[model samples]
Target: VTGSPGAVITLDTTAGVVFQLNPQTFPALDMAGADDIHLRNLSGSEFSTSVNLVADITTLADGVTPIGNNKYFNLVIWGGQNRTGQTSHLYCNLPIGQYGKQGDAIVDAEKFSVHTIPNDFRGVGFLIGELTFQFSSGGGGTWALIQERVLLGHFPILIPGGGTTTIISTFVDSSFEIFGNLDDTKRIAFQADSITTGTTRIITMADVNVDLADIATNNAKVSNVTHTGDVTGATALTLDLNNLGTETSIASGDFLAMVDITDSGSEKITFDNLQANIVKTGALNSGSITSGFGNIDIGSSTIDAGTIDGTAVTATTQLVSNIWKDINALDVKAEYTGSQTGHADFDGTDDSVSIADREEYDGTGVF
Candidate 1:
């Protein structure tokens, strides 16, 4: 026992003997029931009364086992701060394993409770409840149980449309940005007006189908070009070599032709005016040409027909031959018709030039 001002008391045990203290003793007054008792045997041994004492005694049962495996030490405390902020009440030094067992060890629980008049504690967020359980063997450490659980009030719910029980979320002015990659399989979709819940949405596109059955038709040109559908009463189509160069080849189906090709690569083939058509014209001129071999190859001349003209001469052939060879072996078919009597250097530079090579000189002209 301990008294104020450095006065220490002792307890002695004798065989077959018991000792007790009364409230009406020396230097002690008004002490009764276990409420106003204090012990001060501060020696660092098992005799220290501070070892198993607690703020509340309800945790320790009146009759309980002292020590063993699977022991129990439960502490149910009400109205304490969870000071650590981990929970909503107060708890400290909580042992891991023995935190929630019933009493069966050296020490018991420290329990307390608070009762409020609801009006006196209107707005104060006070401590609510705490429970702890702990246990241990004959080690120097005595584990403790600590826990705290809290409760709160309910909020008001606003209903919309009076039919569907929809879950409405109210955010206090918050925005977020999500970024990631998208591929053919994955996509994004729209959900409601402001709410979305899926991981992603997919958008799709397809070929556009046109309905031309109602529109007026246009006159299509067809000739040197092949017409697949209908070109009934249409203007003649022509493939202009305009701006096209030599050494180029044009092909369709199996027919391939190359014409008007040059070595300097300066002069290009010219098709002044070309009418539109589905038919393709493969000129030895500028079109599509593959190098290393012949200038052009018109796959099948039986299908595509046209006169192959060149600078030196003109040749008419059903099949397309070598581009340069045909131009060199051109046959003069346009005969001289004007009368000067004799022939002149086939004045090719002049309009009176004849298809023949012989020319006449002097006023009478040389034959």
Candidate 2:
């Protein structure tokens, strides 16, 4: 039967209607005017019919020249029928119009099936599919089933009210790039058994929740870190101070913060004990001089003192050992020599030295 363009033709073989056609003597059936031909069989008995569909490509201006060479035609079958208990075969004849290349020709085929369940089954409506690729080597080579993937279980579900659709699968071997921004409500979550084995490129990680175990191994890989809280540890943390700049001078009252090893607490200390701890070499500019409980050895340096025990001090060429004797004799003479205005002189034979009111010197004349 001939029909208009894009018309669907259905052959219902129910109610004991016999449809028969012989492939050997029947004429070629052209499918250029029809879009699809569906055969429906609702009867319990088998319906045997054979139809040879052909396309007349020789009617072109240059016969069989418009169709590309070295191309494989693909046949797709899609339906909503439950074929869980039935086994069927599909047969087709593909004519090779021309051959131009000497390489292998590959054909990629895909099948899609949708399964509908009851509403009480958690709304579990899913679509399951698989992809297959077949190749034929050389010209007019026998076609072979190169690979077949059977997708029996595991399907992706779609929500009803435009919610998030979740796909549960054991493994996914594909790459994806998402251009849409993800907020708090929209996010991707991986289970405990899930792992990303490849490199993931993320621009910013602000407001992203990451567990401590996720980055535990990558702690050493960080180049820099800034922390506002205190970082405490059970043991001591050693810091390398070799890169610190040198300090030229330290002020007098400035203190240093240090950890006291005695009590293991932080404390502040001044530079009071610096003189006894460090070796002195340079001249002191301006500071109070005090005894360091040791002998003072001024090596070739002059000791300029203003007064020594409230007495006028002077620089003398005498030795320091003999200068103490002169200092002792002058102390006694100042106590005995009273106010004598004139010199008392007498002859050497009967010379007597006396004072007018002193009786101790009158009886003891030794002239």
Candidate 3:
């Protein structure tokens, strides 16, 4: 019949034992020390008969309290025949059901039946001890069975190695395919070296689309780049002089990079062409005033000098000729004003003449 928690059920060759248990209505069951069945020695006439025992365990317990909902438990039955010295064990997991709720139609009920037969015509006894019930919650037993079946039938088993190595092995013969979309958090990271401090780059859908916003700092290192389109940004671009090649001298044919705002593209101009444009429209055509004297427009500027040497000065204009004439006239006046043998000296208001004699007027005169 009906047995409560920790109920003892004994079996004999001449009789049978039956237990009916409902885990939904019971508190908990712990038959560790009380559920062992002791078999009595069979008589000579009963040696050919077999003893049958049935047990129904519906609820599982941790200690004295029942715990779990929708749990699938494992039942392990182990025993031995002392007379025959034979030992064996049977293990089976329970089905998924709600064992915690009372009057639930999904409650799982398990029944186990054991048959004990005598070894021969001799009197033999059997002892079945230590009936253990292990329980797992949240369909753990079902998940374990699924995993086991997949491992037994799936292709390309996973082994312990690096992630790349594992992926190569998994798709050795076939291409790897993903059916769903991946976000930023789901990325493939790789590094050039195996050092711990090496730079690591992550590749995602944004990276494939060349989205600069999703790029990490110091991760985009390009050696050389050439673009025909305009490259514009909010801030000024700085070039590293140390990374560029040095040139001690430049030729007129040498080209320099420049942006063409008119065409909305990038272009290059030679040094000769650039210089010609500057000379045509620039204020100064030469580096020094002496070399570019013809092109210079002095325009009302005063010239201050200590001496204007006659040999160095050229009468290129009427102003220069007039200046020389004025200096020569002053020298002639100074000589005539000096004392002479016959020459007359005229003051502002009086005129005077000095003569030694009549001979002096002819040729030999001193005054």
lDDT of 1 by residue, 26-79 (tens): 121112222132221112221122213332221223223232333433322111
Off by over 4 Å in 1: 1-367
Candidate 3 TM-score over all chains jointly: 0.19
The lDDT of each candidate is 0.28, 0.28, 0.26
Show the lowest summed lDDT stretch of 10 residues, model 1: 154-163
- Tell me the number of clashing residue pairs for each predicted model: 41, 0, 0
Off by over 4 Å in 3: 1-208, 211-220, 224-227, 243-254, 257-367
In the range 60-127, model 3's lDDT, one tens digit per residue, is: 32212332433323222222222222221111122222222121111111222122223441222222
Better of 2 and 3 by lDDT: 2
Indicate the worst ten consecutive residues by lDDT in candidate 3: 142-151
Clashing pairs in 2: none
Candidate 3: C-alpha lDDT: 0.26
What TM-score does candidate 1 reach?
Answer: 0.16
